[model samples]
Target: MGTSASKLNRAIMADIHRLSLNQATTERWSVKEAVEGCLRHGIPSIGLWRHKIHEAGLRESVRLVRDAGLHVSSLCRGGMFPAPTREERQQRIEDTLRAIDECAELHADSLVLVVGASSAVGLVDARKMVEEGLAAIVSHARESGVRLGLEPLHPMYAGERCVLNTIDQALDMASPYAPMEVGLILDTFHIWWDPYVLQQITRAKGRIYGFHVSDWLVPVPDLLLGRGMMGDGVIDNRTLRGAVDRSGYAGPIEVEIFNQAIWDMPGNDVLSTVVERFTSLV
Candidate 1:
């Protein structure tokens, strides 16, 4: 019985190595604090946000993660492609270019893109803007040795947050660029409900850049901040992780919950809960 228990513990440790704490999960922690928390919890990787990076200052943020030996799984965001005016669109592109430079400095695996939504334009036009935006920046991303990860938010965010709402749509937008230049971020909270998600994951293959996990609560209280922990909702994250594995993505599995209730808890306590749920549910 002791030997069996030892093997189970070893297996759990192996799984923990693949786990990553996305900074958004612990919204209250600064980069320095988040890095310290991850080290204390034995988490090997972290996903960073631009705001936190700036809050801690970029050079120090890089130094802290480097000295602690934490792998940066991916940067939170870099895309907001659709805008009403051409000049504003140009400005957005310039902003993302700077974000790519930051991703390079931190050695993040990819720059996750939450493609923006514009109600002034039709869906088709907004998608076209997204594609155009990608065309403008893919070269800079390649130059900086960064992968652009297209993250499709759930359809409910179609009006204001993200126009890219499905894995297939993201894949289509990424098709024009080389696999290394662009890829897709498969978040279980956003893609699990799609009947074709598994098939799309299969098709993504080498283009799968990041895998984010969080459950979807039924009767969501707030459209923007209603994400749940893995076991707290109905998503089958293990299956999605399996699909991503088969599709050739050997990357960190980032826990990216956005619920207010989870945020209100202390950060270390949140990490403890994430480690447990990730081992059992994801």
Candidate 2:
């Protein structure tokens, strides 16, 4: 590229002040490295994963981000609401409470929740368990000053990963709770195919607690690890992001990807490509 074009790209990135890197996007990077990578690229915020926090001691991880000077957009997850027995269910809720404490410690903006999967008991019972689980933990989360953002995972994951597969369903379950105690996470890869997505996003105007982006590819080899970089697949990132912008969701737009190919690349190289693609395509 010419000097002029390179300068223009930099300027565009500067204007993308709300862009954030979810740690999963560069899975190989340690917490410290992810914070440094964000700093090196002029990225102002990052989303964290709990496993990384455990790997690098919790208190130390919190210190690392504070010293590196970056804002945390959200914690990767805090929900897996359904379990086979009453004892296990309570344990899961307790685990979530700890995650809420961690979020408060790190001063993260929200705690993303992948509600639960439909298990042997049947979808109906599993969903009821999810609501019960949320009811169990919502008060603790609200007291800790952490918002629970329910992420509607792709319908493909309904049977094994997440039973909550649509924005409307998540909203219905969370509607009874206070806004700060319950919210939504909108991700392009999951919701782009819904005919009512735009309408739902509009309805969720003030309820969005976090926003994420990644493309959906054809002939995907692995459902969990086949996310394409922005523009590398079929999603219309610009339109999706524009809709979020118009909906009064002025918070950071996170780049959360989980592809083996991306993880295999050098972290710095992957981060460079992420910024370039986000600037041009998202």
Candidate 3:
């Protein structure tokens, strides 16, 4: 190898410890299969999705991860805090509590909350609902030793996916709680378009609980599932990752692409690409 190539290879190896595969990246894999894949690929950690866990049975999922001695980076979800009726709102809160328990059982680093958007109410009310929902579950999360990671989606998803659409918004929502009880989840695909992202990442500082990396495909094919693999799209992942590193977050950097094309590939092929891209691009 050339000198530059040698140095780059060394750097990739040194940083490999921080790489984690988010289960959604291999959307077709069950929880057991994901754990085995992580082991085969020398991945030190994984980000699990709730559906995969349920499909494998939570007990078996926990056993597989623990047996492999793989770290659970974070759980894929735990929040959808807006609903039209009072009863429905309470139901959402209850659901979050259950997720928290699952997070605790898995010994995951954090429970990533994609905080749902508003339909029956205005954005302002929806945000309030999110806050109320957090208030309802924060205590349980803390008691269970699970941190709630509030992930901000892109502004385009403000109406249907996530109400918290910027690092600033997520930080503001997390401000009232203790850092251990609630922290920010920075996903490059979602927050890359924000002009104040670096500044807000600095503001997040010690409160950054998780970091996810995926590219934003131009001319998006599917609104929610259009994420590209690292280096395949427009995001400057290295810069964003540097910002997160500066913010005191040294946890796993999960590759979480949601594109159908990638999902259709063989699971092992996807893992190989993820490892290569994560080392070179992210």
Candidate 4:
């Protein structure tokens, strides 16, 4: 057999350096500034939101990230799929195609999808619309060489954020079509409540293109803004990380928190805390 040193070297080579910061954690920072901060902290990657990109001119934003040598793990979002009317639905699809262009411009790894919720229709109709919209956008995404990362928001968000409330549901929507470059974005906070999380993660396998980390607060205060820092809440990051590792996923763990309190702090301080939490506690 080969020496222990040789075996160790091989294992090290295969080890995944999975770490990234989602800009939303430091929502106060400008897009360019966030990229610079992340680079300064030795973070190799980031996930960006469209609003932030629009705030900073697209070309300038792309140039800034390129200058810092940071990879965009994924464009923050794209899939608000449901609308009350046909015109609105078509418009969302058009907008997502535009978002795909932006992702390509940024050389992002994927375009995260938060499939929209039902507007005036029932949940079932809303889900169907999400599937239809994704099918429409997948072609454009392929042409642009951008991957789609379908994110299943928690059940609480099913009424307003996403109709696809589970990993299996998101996977089912993407599996049949299987765009040449499309995949899913697994978020621990949203999926942790599911008893079948491990099974779904295994089912995802190679299709998991991104992973987001955040903790869920007990007695959740606000549906949208009460996210906890990784170790500050109930979710078990270690177990989730192990499952992803076993599933053969080697991607950045994008930290996406929408806490009102965190957002109130200084941008630099928030970034610092996130980095510290990720290393020491998460």
Candidate 5:
């Protein structure tokens, strides 16, 4: 068999117990509904957002997920580190520490971090602030036994969403942090456009704690919300997955998309499509 074929076989036989769905894919679904949907689809894992947990009530959400025997790949987000003042930055850290507590409650694999963007200063200073903020939260996460996964947003979102815009940058930030304590969330959509993707993936190796999948729309209308379904956009997730697998990081493949168009459809239909597309194309 050729490399792709061999990889496909390995992927098939590897007991893909870690396939997960992020609730953002079907925004119409409540947290309870999304958990039910994952169970219906035979997806064993999920990534949850703080808002959904709040809406569903934290205790109930925990009860439902535990009863269903679902694995939380990671919490959706916990970082918005770039603030205008020292007080605001400290507030963000405290909020993230709370998020860590929630992750522990949910028994999530890690807490995903979308490090916030620059203030009026610039990208360099903003990145520095993010690093400082992450360092501040590392001790708390360690104490709570929650691993931190830093997600690098695409450069397009660098101004507002995340200042950490490349896998290399994310790896650099996480290298000193220790893999058991903190790591990187490797997402194809954000890092696909990078020229150094493969090299960075190779370097990340064991430090890749979480893997999220989404495609890049050619003419991305809304940078934050116009995420395409896997196989519907330009990213070659199979190749990306190959690199990830080769790096010896066997973890959950969490699908996270934020397309308003898809969210308007029936939640089941959206989830069914994601499962179909992930199986056939990813």
Candidate 6:
């Protein structure tokens, strides 16, 4: 084993703790049901999505989560920066600010940003929009004490979902702000294919605010809907986990699978499988 003592120590901690279920993994579960599923599965944390919280009412959702004794690992999303017009961009900014407010209300660890891309514009213009939008919200995020998690989605999502599609691009976008106010979300599903992934994760070190673990399905059927379960795909997550652990990120590793087949399963069944898969694999 090439592991140093520090890496081994972090790996042990990662194994025994620091795992969370993202609600997206079980798309049909209500907020209350998701919290209960976590409790049933002995999972101590959750990564929440916006719609589920809205369905239960934000304050009520907060009370439910706190009562169940679960930590909000992170909020699903807060960015859609690219727009055809200035007014739309401003509207996106306002909505992101409100999203920041929501992140605070839920007491989430971070508000993940899947910064949107615009098909109408060139890549350069789209990136510019993202930069300008972050400039507007970074201060508000600091004041609210919620970190901005810049999630560089897979390049396949670049045309429509997010323009920032690599760790380097996410880091370049974040370099303008203090590390505490802005950081990266290292999602294994998205970043696993990058050759420099481990090197980049180590370079970022203490600034990684969130770590999302999911597998990439080979012959991926749908660009957005084909995420594999932890052990069901091509990634060797143990190595990736070691890299993130060595990077000084001790946060919960969120499991987010978007496959429709998995979503069709019963919520409890899904949670049970998630616990099993995460234990045997990640």
Highest lDDT among the candidates is held by which one?
Answer: 1
Instruction: Give the C-alpha lDDT of model 5.
Output: 0.87
Per residue, candidate 3 scores C-alpha lDDT tens digits across 187-273 of 998889988888999999989999999998888889988999888889999999999999899999999989899999999999989
The lDDT per prediction is: 0.92, 0.89, 0.91, 0.84, 0.87, 0.89
Candidate 6 vs. true structure, TM-score: 0.94
RMSD (Å) of each candidate, 1 decimal: 1.1, 1.6, 1.5, 4.6, 3.7, 4.6
Q: Candidate 1 residues 167-201, lDDT tens each? A: 88888888988888899999999999999999989
lDDT of model 6 at position 200:
88
Q: Number of clashes in model 2?
A: 0
Candidate 3 has an lDDT of: 0.91
Q: Which regions in candidate 1 have their CA more than 4 angstroms from the true location?
A: none
- Per-prediction TM-score: 0.98, 0.96, 0.96, 0.92, 0.93, 0.94
Model 2 ranges with Cα > 4 A deviation: 1-10
Best by TM-score: 1
Ranking by TM-score: 1, 3, 2, 6, 5, 4
> Could you tell me the lDDT of residue 123 within candidate 5?
80
**Candidate 6 per-residue lDDT over residues 1-282, each given as its tens digit:** 456967865665456468898999988899998899988877899999988888989999999999999999999888898999999999999989998999999899999999999998878899999999999999999999999999998898888989989898899889988999899998998889999998889788878999888888788878888998888889888789889988898889899999999999888888778877776687
- Measured with C-alpha atoms, the lDDT of residue 240 in candidate 3 is 97
Worst 10 residues of 3 by lDDT: 117-126
Clashes of each: 0, 0, 0, 1, 0, 0
